[model samples]
Target chain A: MSFLAVEELVARIPDGAFVALPPDYSGCAMAAVRGLLWRPARGLRLLGVPQLGLQADLLIGAGCVAEIETAALSLGEHGLAPAFGRAWEEGAIAVRESTCPAIHAGLQAAEKGVPFMPLRGVLGSDLLGLRPDWKVIDNPFAEKDPILLVPAIRPDVALFHAPLADRAGNVWIGVRRELLTMAHAARRCLVTVEAVTEEDLLADDRTAAGTIPALYVEAVAEAPGGGWPVGLQGAYPADDAWLARYAREARTEAGFTAMLAEFVAR
Target chain B: MTREEVLLLIAEVARLLEGCRHVAVGALSPIPAAGALLARELADGAMRVSILGSRRHSPFTDGGRELFDCAAQGRIDAFFLSGVQIDGAGNVNLLGLRREGRPIRRFAGNFGAPYLAFLVPRLILFRTDHDPRSLVERVDFVTAPGSGPPGVWRRGGPVALLTPCCRFAFRDGRFLLESLHPGHDLEEIRARTGFAFALAGEPAVTPPPPEDWRARILGPVREALAEVYPAFAAGLGG
Candidate 1:
C-alpha cells in the first residue's frame, strides 16, 4: 500500500480499540496522537508497552482514553505528568497497574500465539491482586516452585512513529525492537514515519536487521517530524522545555483545556 | 538536597557497589547513576555501567526487556531502587499514597522494582528523605517485598538503604543501624523513623566523599552523567 496521511492512518483505529504504545524514549507517534485529538476516539483502552509519557497524558487529559494499563506514566526528567496522575488519583479513568516485565511477557505471549507466559518475581506484590488475569501456578517441573503466569495481551492496534519506511511498507525502528513485538501481537499495526525512502530497507543487511517487513504493518503514513515533543531515537531529541510547559499547564482542569486549545488546531 | 549531601550519597553508593561487576541505574536516579559512573571510574573502566535513557551509557540493544533479562541471567550484579515508602521490613511502595482509602497522590509506578528487586543481588535502596511518613512501619502497598514466604523464590533483595540522615544495613528482614550522617544523631533517627530497628551498638559517623574518587566524580563522572541528567549534573558543577 502507498503512504497515507497521518490523519488517515489514525482513522483506521476503531473507537474503543486496545492500542499499545511505546515509551517516551522509544518512538512515540505524537503526530498521530495529535491527529487523534482532532478525530476523537472514545472509550479507548490504552496499553503502554511498559510505560508511557506525554502522548498518554494528552489522550487521558482529552478524555479520549477510558482505560489505561501501564507500569509507569512519567515525563522522565521533565517533571510530573499531571493529567495521568490526576486521572489515577480521581479515578476518572480505569487504572490497571502493572510492572514492566509483566506487560512485556504478556505481549510476548501473544506474539508467540501462546495462552500465557511465565515470569519470575511479582509473586508477593499487591499488583497480583489487581490483575485477575494473572495466576500463580506451581511449576509442574519443579517440586515446589511457584511462578507468575500472565495472560496474553493481544492488542487490537499497535501504533507508533518510526524514523523511516520504504515504499514496500517495511519500517525501520533501529534498536527499539519492542515495536516488533507490538506489531506482531496486535491485529493491525499503524505506523507514522518521519520519512519514506525510495531505497529498499530490507535489501541492505545492516538495515534489514532493524526492519519490520510489510507483512506485519497494516498501514504507513508519511508524517514528517512525526515523533515531536517526545522523539525518535536518531531522528530528534525530546523537547524538554515544551514537555515542562505541558506538565505545568496540564495540572488544573482549565490549564489542561488551555493546553488542548493551544495544541489542537482550531 | 545540598551539593555536599549529593556528593556524600554518591560516595556512599559507590562504596556499596565496590565489588559489583555490572550495575544498572534507572531513570530519574542521578545520585545512583553518578555513583555507578564513579565506581566504573574507580575500577579503571573495568566495570559495566548501564544508565537508562542514555544511548551512550546503556549497552542494551535488544530493548527494555534486556535489562530484566540480564538480571534474570545473573548478568547484573547490583541495581538501585527507591520507594515512596520503605518500611522496617524493607517492603517498598512505589505505588501512590492514600487518604482514607482514597488515592490522593500517585508516583511513577514501580517500573521494574518488582522483578529487579528479586533478581539482582545487592539491591541498594536509596531515598534522599529520611522521615517518619516515608519510613513507615508498613507500606500501604507492597510493590516488592523485602523477603517472602519460605517457599518463595528470591535470589536477592535489599542489602542496604542509604539516606541523607543515615545508612542502614538490611539484615534479618529488618533495618539495622550502621552509621549516622554528620549533623544527625541517634535520637533524630529514632524520632524520624516510623518503625522499630535494631540499634546493635552506637552507630558510627558516615564518611565524606573519599579523596581519591572525589575529583573523578566532579570531573569525568559528572561530564558523563550530563548525557542523561543535564539538569542534575549542572547542580554538582559548583
Candidate 2:
C-alpha cells in the first residue's frame, strides 16, 4: 500500500470531481478539503451523504463547488450554514434537493451494483415534481401499490478522515458503518487519519469487524487532527467556541474570507 | 424562549406521544428530545428514545441507514418536524420560499421528512414562529404532505400541529383548532393564522405546566438533556 503525502493524494482528484462527503458528525477529511482549496480547482460537485455542514459550506463559499445534492445543509445547533445559505439565496449553485433515506437508498443501490433503488413515500411531494429522474412506478410485486425509484449515485471519490489506520492500510471506523457503505458505493476512497498503527488492523478480530480493507481504500495519509472543528466520533469533541465564532462571523462574505485566511494561515 | 415556555411545549409533546414504544428524534431537536425522554420517564422506563446525534441515547450501531430501516420496518412510532412554512393541508416546507417559481429564501433543506412522515405513525409538527407568514394558506413547496393522491402509498402523517398560539389537530386534510395555551386567545390565533381552520366548540385553555417542573425537568430530565444538549441544559432556569 502506498501512503502518499496528504496534498499529493489530493492532487490526484481532478477538477470537477464528484466527491462524496460524510455528514458533520461523521469523520470529515478537512485537511484534504483544504488541500483541494490550495489547488485552485473549480466546478467541483459535492454529494452530502444525506446531509452536510461546515465542510460543504466552506467549499461552496470558496467558490470551488458548482453543484450540491443533499437532504439538508446545516450547522446543527450552531445555526444555518451561512455560505451555503447565501449561495442558495443567490441561486449561485445548482441545488438538487433530496431526502435522507432517498440518498441512502440511492447509494445502497450502487453498493449492490444495481441501477436504481425503489423507496417508500414521496409520491405526492413537490420535491418529486422537480426531480424528473426520480420516477414513480407501480410496484411489480404488489397490486395497485406505487413506489419511488431513485437512480444510483456513483461518486468519483469518497473522502473522509478517521481515528486509526493500520500498516496494511485498513482503516478502523468502529461502529460508523455508513463510512463503509460510502466506500463501497464510490469509485475509490481516500482517507486521512489521526494516526497509523504499526500492527495489522485485521490481525485482531475486534478491529477487523470494523475495518475497511485496503482493497476498498484507494490511498491513505496520516494527518493528525485532520477532522478538527468537526468532531471525529468516539475520538474527539467539536470545538464549540470555534464553531460558534464561525457561525457568528461567517454570516458575511468578508467575515468568511477573514476566517478562511486565519484558517489556512494556521 | 423562557424555560417555562419550553417546558410547556415539552409537556404538550409528551402528552401527544404518551404510549409510543420507540420515538426517534432528529439532531438538534432539544424540545422533542426532552419530551421523548420525559414520556419515557413517565412510562417508568418502558419506552425507548433515540436522539440522532447522541451516541448515549441512540441504539443505532449500523450508522445512519439503520434509523431509516428501523422506521420502515414499522418500529418508530413518533417523530418531530418543524417547517419554515406549514399549510392547512399539513404540507411542510423546510426548503426555501419560492416566489414566482424561483426560490428566494432558504431554510435548512428537508432532512428525513419525506420518508419518516409516512412511516412514523405519530408525526408531530411544531413551529416556534406562529405568524401568518410561517403558517401559510399553502406551502410554496410540499416537502412532506399530510394527504396524498388516491393510491399514493402513505402509512401515517401529521397527528397534530403545535404553535406558540395554540395546538391544531389534523383531520380530513385540514387543521382544526384543538386548544389554546394560557394567556393566548382565539382572536390572536385567528388574526395570526394565514389559513381558515375549523372550530368545534368553545376552545379550552391547555392545562398549565406543573409548577414543580424543577423537580422533574431539572432533575433526571436535565441530566439526560445535558448529555445531548449541554448548552441548552446549562441555559435552563427555574
Candidate 3:
C-alpha cells in the first residue's frame, strides 16, 4: 500500500480502472497516469468533484475520461467554454442540476453510506430530478418529509496531489482544501506529494492538518510538477500560452492527441 | 405548423430583444444574432451587434470591441444567457457531475453569469428545451444572483425566462408565463414542465421570420462557426 515513488505507484494501476479524481488539477497524477497508458483504457470514467483550474483540463486532455459530467458553471482559467456544448453534442459531456456545492454534498453523503442527507436549504430545485438514478424517497415514519437518497460512493481509486505529503502518505493541501472530501470518498488513494519529510504532518501546521490523514491513503508518490500542462499553486501559474494552444487543439480527438504529445514533450 | 412558422417564432423572440444596447450572440446563436441584425436594420443601425467569436471588432467602422467584453461596456442594457437548469427562484447551473455516487458532475461554474446578473439591468434566460426538468421549482446552485439582496434585482433583474414552448417573466415576486411560441398551446406547454406554470390567455403570437432572415443570419454564422469550431462544423452539413 505504501510506495515511495510515483512511477512505482502508477505501475500498480491496472488498465481500465475507473479513476475518481479531484477537480482543479492537483499535481502530476494526471500526467503520470497518461504516461503509463498507451491509449486511455475503456470504462475510463473520470469523476471530478469541483476544484477548478488545470486539474479538470488535464483529466479531459489525457483521453481517459470518455465523458465529462459536471455541475460547476465555468471552466475558470481552464477556458473550456467553447468545448462545453460540443462535448454534449459529441456525447462526451452532461451538465446536471445541482452544481458543485450540491455534487460535493452528495458525494459526502454517499461516502458515509447514509440513507439520505438533508442539505438545509437545497430542497426546492431541479437537481433533485436531474439524476434519474437517485431518488428523493419520502420517509414513511416522518410526516410531510422527504430525504434526498444519494447512493453510496466508493471510487475505485483516488489520485490526489497535495502541497505536502510524507513517504508514509500524510498529506496537506495548504490553504486550498478543496479535495479533502475526495480522499475520504475514494476507496483507494494514490497521493502525489510535493515534499516528503520526516516531521509529523499534524505538528508542522495546524491549518493544513485536517486536509488528509495518512491512514486513508494507500500510496504516496513523490511527483513534483505532477500537475503539468496544468500548473500547481505556489509553483507556477497555468501556462496561459500553452493553454491558448490547447484551447485551439482540444476541439477534436486528433487535436487532443497532438496536445497530449506536446504536454508530454514539455 | 410549418418550418416558416418556427422561423417566425424565432424572429419574434428577436423583436423582443429591445433593452440590450449591446448584445452578444454566441458563435452559432443565429436566431439571436438575426434578431440583433434585424433590430439594427429596423433601427437604422442604431443598435450594435457583437458576435462572440468573430475578429473582436468589425472592420466596418462602428462595432463593439469584443463580444466577450460586452458586459463591461456601459452601453450594454440587457444580457441574454441560456439556462440549462432553472429553479423557481430563477437560479441556474450549466456544469455537469464528474463522479459516480457523486449526485452531480464538477464544472467551472458560470463564467459570465455573475457579471451579467449584476451588471446588466435585464437578464434574459432562454432554453430550447421546455421540458419538465429545465423549468424547475429550484436550481441546485445559484452561480448568479437573479435578485441580489431582495430589492436590488427589482430594478431590472431576470426580465424573462424564454422556452421553446412558452415564455415566462418575473414581476413583483411572481413567475408569470408571458407568451407561447406559435402553435404551442397552453396544454402542451403545461405538459412539458414539472413545475406549476401559469398560462396567459391569447398570448402574443410569436412573430414570423422576414423572408430572407434565416439565410442572412444562419448562413454567415454557419460559415463563421465552421471556422470557429471546425469539428462541430464538420457535422452540420449532414
Candidate 4:
C-alpha cells in the first residue's frame, strides 16, 4: 500500500500536482522535500502558519512553484515559533498568512472538494480582508456573535515527516504532534520517518503515536538527516556552523545554485 | 538608584549582543528590541535589524514578523524572550491558562521558538518578573531548548538568563549568579526565584551604563524604524 524507497515515493507525485507541507521545526521532512522538488515540474502550494520553520524558505528557494497563499498571526507562537523568522533574515522568499486556522481549514475544505465551509469565531479582525474570496455566512443557530465562515483548501498532496511511521503509512508524530491537523485534512498524504518498527500501531505509545489509522496514508519512506543542515530534536540540533555557512552563501543566485549542487551531487 | 538607573543598567548588557545580520522587534517587546538595536549599532552598519513580516528572505513568509523567525533557516545568533513558565531544562511557556469550561484562549505566538532553541547559537533569557512562577522547577512546554539540566548551558546550549533582580549564567549544567542588579542583594533576589543556584566567587557588580547607549543604540534605531513605522516610535516609548 506504500512505497519503500525515496525514488519510488517521489515517482508517485504527478508533475502538475499541488503539494502541501507542515512547517514544524521538530522533523527533517522539509529538507527531504527539498531534495524531491529540486528542478521540479510540479506546481507547489504551501500551507502553514508563517511562523513555522523553513516552509517559506524552501518554497521561495525553489523559486519554481506556481502560487502561494499566506495568513499572518502573532509574533511569538504562530509567527516565530518554528524557524521562518531565521529563514527570512538570510534572504529566503516568503509570504504572510493572515489567520492561523485559515490555511489549514482551507486545505481541509479543498480536500473535501467543497467550495467553502462556514466556520465560527472569526469576526472584526484583519483576517476578513486577507481572505476576500471566501464567503461569509451568519450562524443563525447561535444567540451570541453569530457570523461564521471558513475557506476550503484541498491540496493535491500533503507531505510531512514524523518521528516514526509504520510501513503501512501509520504516522507517529513525536513530541509536538503538529501534523495531526494536516494529516487529517489532506487529500493525499506522504510521510517519511526515522525508521519503521514492526510493533503494532496500537502498541506504539498513544501520546507519541499521533495521526494514526493505516488507511489514510499513501506512502512511507525512511530518510535520515532528511532534515539535514536543519536540526532534528531527539536526533540532532541544527548544525549551527553549517547553517551559518548556508546563511552566508544563500543570499545570491549563484550561491543558492552552488549549495543545491552540493546537495544534488551528494 | 532609579528606574533610569535600571534602564541604563539593562542597557549596559547590550555589550553582550552580537552576530546578527538581520533582526526584528515585536510589539510590546522592549528588552530584546533594545538589545538587538544596541547590537546593530555596535556593528556600525555591518548587521541588519528588522521587524517581522519585512520583505526579507525567510522560510516562513514575511507576513507578521514574529520572534520565532530568529531561528528560521538556523540563522539567528541570539534571541531574548520572557517565560510565563520555565522548567529546569529551560523550556518556556508564555501561554497563560484556561478558565473553567472555557477551553483555552490562546495568544499570538511566532511558531519558531523551538526551532530557535535547536538552531540559534545563543538564546538570552529575559524576564521582568523574578517570582516563583517565572522561575519554576520545570516548564509546561519545551517551547525552546535548555534540554538537559539547569547547568547544561555551559556545555554548548543556552547562554544567559537576565531578570529584574539578578543575572544568571549556565555553566556545567548549573546556574551561577553572574551579578546583581544595582541596589538589589542576593537574599532578596533568592527569595523570588524557584530554582537553586551557586554564587559566583565574588558577587560581581552589574555593568555600568555607557553614556552613549541611549543615543547610539536607541536613537539610530528609532530613526531607521520610523521610516516604515511612524506608530512604532510611540511603541518604543520615545
Candidate 5:
C-alpha cells in the first residue's frame, strides 16, 4: 500500500472519469476536491451517493463535472446548491436525476457484480418517464407485480475522506457502510484520512466492525482537515461558519471564482 | 406570516401525527421537524422522531441507508415531503419546468420522495409558499405520484397537504379542502390556488393550538430544533 500526497492522489484520477462521491453525513474529501480543482480536471462525471452537498456544487462551479448522476444536490440546511442549479439551468451539465434509494440499489448491484438491480417504487413517477434506460418489468418471482430495474452503477473511482486509516490501508469508516459499497463497486478506491494509525484497526473487535479491510483500498493518503467545511463523521465537526460563508459567496460566478481563489488556489 | 401562525400549523401537524409511532423529517423541512418534536413531547416520548440530519433525533447509525431500509420494512409511520410545485391531483414536481431536452428552471433532484411516498404509512406534504405558481393545476414533472394504480402494492401515499393558506386532505386521488387558516377564507384560497379542489362542505377555521402547548413549542421545541436547523431556530424570534 502506498501513501501519497493529496495532489498526487487526485492526479491519479484521469479527466472524464466516472467518480463516485460519499454522501454529506459520510466523510467527503473536500481536500481532494480542491486538488482536482487546482489540477483543473475537466469532463469528470460525478456519481452522488444518494445526495450531494458542497462538494458537488464546488466541482460544478469549477467546471470539472460534465455530467452528474445523483438523487439530489442541495446544501442541507444552507438551502439550495447554487452552482448545481446554475449549471443545470444553463445546460452546462448532463444530469441523470435519480431517487436516493435507487442510487443505493444501483451501487449495490455493482457491489454484488450484478448487471442490474430491481427496486420498488418509482414505477409510476415522472422519474421513470424521463429515464428511458430504466425499465419497469413484472417481478418474475411474484405473479404480476411490476418493479423498476436500474442498471448497475460501476464507477471508475470512489473517493472520500475518513477519520483514520492504518498503514496497511484499511480505512475505519465507522458505521457509514455506503463507503464500503462504493469501494467494493468501483474499479479503484482512493481515500484521504485525518490520521494514519500505527496500530492495526482490525485488531480490536470494536474497530473491526467499522474498518474497511485493506484488500478493497487502492490508495491511502493522510490529509487532516480533509473534509473541512464538510464534516468527517466521528472526527471533526463541520466548519459551519465557513460553510455559511461559502453558501453566501458561491451565489455568482465572480463570487465562486473568488472563493476558489481564496480556498483552493492558496 | 407570524410565528404564532406557523406554530398553529405545526400544532395541526402534531394533531395529524397523533397515533404515529415513528415520524421522519427529511432535509429542508424545519416546520415538520418542529411538529414531530412537538408531537413526541405531547405523546410523553411515545412517538419516535427522526430528523434526517440531527445527531440527537436520528436513531440510525448507518447514515441514510438505514432510513430507507426502515421505511421499506414498514417501520417508519409517517414522513414529510415538499415540492417546487404541487397539483390538485397530489403530484409533486421537484424537477423544474422541462422544455424539450433540459429543464428551463432547475431545482433539486428527487431524493427519496418516490420511494418513501410508497413505503411510509402516512405522508404529509407541506409548503410554506401558497400561491398560484406553487399550487398548480398540473405539475410539469411528477417526482412522486400521489396515488398509484391498483396492484401497485403501496402501503402508503399522501394523506394530507398543508399550506400556509389552508389544509387539504387527499382522497380519491385528489385533494379535498379540509379547512381554512384563521385569516384566510374560501375566496382567497380559490384566488391563490391554481388547481381545482373539492371543498368539504363549509370550510371551518383551523383551530389554534392550546395556550399552554404554545409555550412548550416556543421553548423546548425551539431549543431542540437548534441542533439540526440553527438558521430556522434563530429566525423564530424575528
Candidate 6:
C-alpha cells in the first residue's frame, strides 16, 4: 500500500493532467487543494463534476489551473465566485462550458467504459452551438427525434476527501455515490480521509455497500479537517464565518492573494 | 428593488407554483427558495419543496446526481432557473459574454438547466435584474433553451418569466407580456426591455402580495432561507 504525504501525492500529478474534483456538497479535498496551492502546482486542467466552489476559485486565483471544464462555478449562497470570474474575464484560462446533466452523462460514460453517452437536452440551444465537439444525431430508435451526445470524461486522477477508510484502503462514502463514479471513471483515485481505521470496512455488509474497494484507490493520506471551510458530509460542518470572510475579502486580486498567503502559505 | 417589491416578486413566484406537487430550487436561488417554501407552507405541507444545499429541505442523500435523476424522472413538478441574460425567445444565457475564442465576461457555467428545463413541467424563469442588458434580444449563449424543435422530446419549458419590471408568459417559443409589476407600466417595460414581445391584450398590473403572505415571507420564510442563504436572508429587513 502506497501511503504518501499530501504534497507527494499532489506532486505525482504531472502538469497539464486532467484532474477531476467532486461537487461542492460532495466530499471535496480542500486539504489537498491547499497542499497543491502551497506546492504551487501549475498547468492543471481542472474538471468540475456539475459544480465547483472554493477549490476551483482558489486554484484559478493562484494561477495553478490552465483550463477548466465544468457545469458551473459559484460559491452557492456566498454569491459569485470572484476569482473564477476574474480569471475568466481576463481570458486567463480555457473554459469548456457545459450543463450539469451533460457532465454527469460524460462521467457516467467513462464509468461504464464507453466512448460517449447520449443526453436528452441542449437541443436548439446555443450551448450546442458553442460546443462543436458535442454532436447531435437523430434517434435511431425514434425517427425524427434529435438527441445530444457528449463524449466520456475520464480524468487522469480523481481526488476527493472522505470521512473514513479501513486498513484495506476501502473508503466508506455513504450515499455520495457520485464519488464512486468519479473513482471508477478516473485512471487513478487519490483520497484524503479524516481517519484510517484498522477495521475491515468490507467485512460488514452495510459498510461494504458504501465502500470503494482499494482496487480503485491509488493512494490514501490522512488529512484531518481536509475539507475545512467547505465541510465534509457527516464528518464536519462548513465553516460559515470563514466562508463569509472569504466571500467578502476575496473580491479583489490583492485581497485574494493576501488570503492565500495567510490561510494557505502559512 | 425594495424589500416589499422583493417580497411581492417572491409571492408572485409562489402564486405560479400554486398546484405544483414538487418544486426544486437550485443553488444560489434565495428568492425562488423563499417562494417555494412559502408555497409549501400555504399548501399545508401538501407541496414538497427541495432547496439544494439545505439538509432539511433536500430529501436526496446523493447530492446533485439524485436531484438530476429525480428531475429527469418527472418527479419534480416545477424548478427555477436564472441567467446572466434572457432573450425574447425564452432562451437563458448563464454563460457570460463570449468572444470568438473565449468569453469576455463569464458569470457562471450552466448548471443542470438544460435537462431540467425540458423535464420539469413548470420551469419558472426569474431574474432580479430587469433591464435591457439582461432582457436581451438574443442571448450570446443558450444554457437552457426556452423552446426546442418539434421533434425534440421535451415535456416542459419556461412557463413564466418574472422580472422586477413585468411577468412574461412563454408560449409557442415566444414571451408575451402578461402583467406589469406595480410601480411599473407597459411603456416603462417596453422602454427597458431589449427584446420584443407580444402584448396580452392590455397588460394588467401585478397584484400585490397578500398581508398574510407578506408576513409569512418576512417572518418564517426568512428564517428558512437563512439555512441555505445566510447572506441574503440576513440582509432581508423585517
What TM-score does each of the candidates earn?
Answer: 0.98, 0.97, 0.53, 0.49, 0.96, 0.92
lDDT of model number 2? 0.88
lDDT of 3 by residue, A48-164 (tens): 554333444544445445544344423444356434435544566434333344445555765686744443222333344456756655566666555445455556777767667
Docking class of 3: incorrect
List TM-score (chain A only) for every prediction.
0.97, 0.98, 0.79, 0.77, 0.97, 0.97
Candidate 5, residue B147: lDDT:
87
Query: What is every candidate's C-alpha DockQ against the true complex, given to 2 decimals?
Result: 0.77, 0.80, 0.05, 0.04, 0.68, 0.62
Candidates sorted by DockQ, best first: 2, 1, 5, 6, 3, 4
Which prediction has the highest lDDT against the true structure?
1
Per-residue error (Å), model 3, residue A198? 3.1
**Tens-place lDDT digits, model 4, residues A159-212:** 776667655567776543435545556777777777787766656466334545
State residue A128's C-alpha deviation in candidate 1, in Å: 0.9
lDDT per residue for candidate 2 within A27-82, as digits (tens), equals 99988888887776689999989898889998898898999999999988899999
lDDT by candidate, in order shown = 0.89, 0.88, 0.55, 0.54, 0.87, 0.86
Q: What lDDT tens digits, residue by residue, belong to model 5 across residues B48-111?
A: 9989877787888664578998998899999988999999888988877766755678777799
For A1-266, candidate 6 gives per-residue lDDT tens digits of 46878887777787788999987789998888988888788999988887788999999999999988888888876788989888877878888878888888899999899999998767866677768899998898987888899999999999999999987789999878888888989999999999999999999999898999999999988888888888988888888788888888899999999887876954
| Candidate 6 Cα outliers beyond 4 Å, as residue runs | A244-252, B99-102, B215-223, B234-238
Q: Compared with the true structure, what per-residue lDDT tens digits does model 3 show for residues B62-122?
A: 1111222344344566566665567666666654333333434334454345334555566
Prediction 6: B-chain TM-score: 0.95
The true-versus-predicted C-alpha distance at residue B195 of model 2, in Å, is 1.4
lDDT of 2 by residue, B62-160 (tens): 878999999999999999999989998999988878899877788778888888888888999988768999899999988998887679777799999
lDDT of 1 by residue, B129-235 (tens): 99999999989888999988578788999999999999999998999999999899999999999989998889999989877778989899999999888889988
Ranking by lDDT: 1, 2, 5, 6, 3, 4
Off by over 4 Å in 2: B211-214
Where does candidate 3 stray beyond 4 Å? Answer: A25-28, A36-39, A51-63, A67-69, A81-87, A92-98, A110-115, A120-127, A139-142, A205-211, B1-169, B172-238
Backbone clashes in model 5, listed as residue pairs:
none
